[model samples]
Target: MHVLVVYESLWGNTEQVARAVADKLGSVGTVDVVDSDAAPITVDGYDLLVVGGPTHAFSMTRAATRAEAVKSQSALHEPARGIREWLNLLGRPSAAIPAIAFDTRVDKPRMPGSAAKAAKHELRSMGFGTTVKQETFRVHGYEGPLLDGELERASAWADEVIAALGLGSRADR
Candidate 1:
């Protein structure tokens, strides 16, 4: 199985999670990971697509939110374009390609909503089949190293995704 993992991150927390997911998926098959800014606007050959980003303003980051992040977070590098724009450019994919969406968010009580959920809805609207439910990994704060064990949790989720796709060990191949 070939997989593509794309992500948009401001403080690097979401990028870490994307790498973890891609690394785990790599154990099962070929996986390519790219930042949303660097990702191709089309999904042509991949069998699976995984997209993730940080939650901003209860959903994916908008241009305004990205500007705020750049202005407020001195350590953050300027993002060329966020996942929202990347997804918008990717109108739809062939029905054979399945997708999963994830996001990194503050671990606060009653956090308004999730970017992963919003992304999943968008993917569905674009006619992509989702093999797994949208997932979220928590961060202790806005700029984060990720909450404890989140990377392990993300890797485990990749295992579940592989199983759902009916891909057994690739050792024999």
Candidate 2:
């Protein structure tokens, strides 16, 4: 039940959510939460792949978008590579490994489009099975202190994903 939680975060909000999700998943099995660029080239050893990123221009971040975020100087941290580029560079897995996607977006003016949705397509395109449905955590604005309780919700979502997969191996459960 090894899990790989890979993500791209601009303002670190998405990174926070990613860690919270990985924390819950740790009860099930080993979990490695890494930046998208630092992720493995292949999904060979993992049982599940959980991916997340901040929604940029309504989808996964691009080079231009990331540059813009950096230019705006609003991000606490910027990923060296975004999820979009990482996926492109990833190797095609031999099997359709189970996966889920998540994103951080503006909480107030709920927008159209989702990094999660786009990520689902990318993962499926790369032969990964889309297991649990995609989720979107919210932030106050672009560069955000994540809206309160999003971390809790992220952990809960991890448990739900495991349940949906019938993994039934949470350490506490």
RMSD of each: 1.5, 1.6
Ten contiguous residues minimizing lDDT sum, candidate 2: 164-173
Q: Give the TM-score of candidate 2.
A: 0.94
Candidate 1's C-alpha lDDT? 0.87
Minimal lDDT window, size 10, model 1: 71-80
Instruction: Return the number of clashes found in candidate 2.
Output: 0
List lDDT for all candidates, in order. 0.87, 0.89
Cα-based lDDT at residue 126, candidate 2? 84
Q: Highest lDDT, which number? A: 2
Off by over 4 Å in 1: none
lDDT of 2 by residue, 16-63 (tens): 999999998888899999999798889898888998998888899988
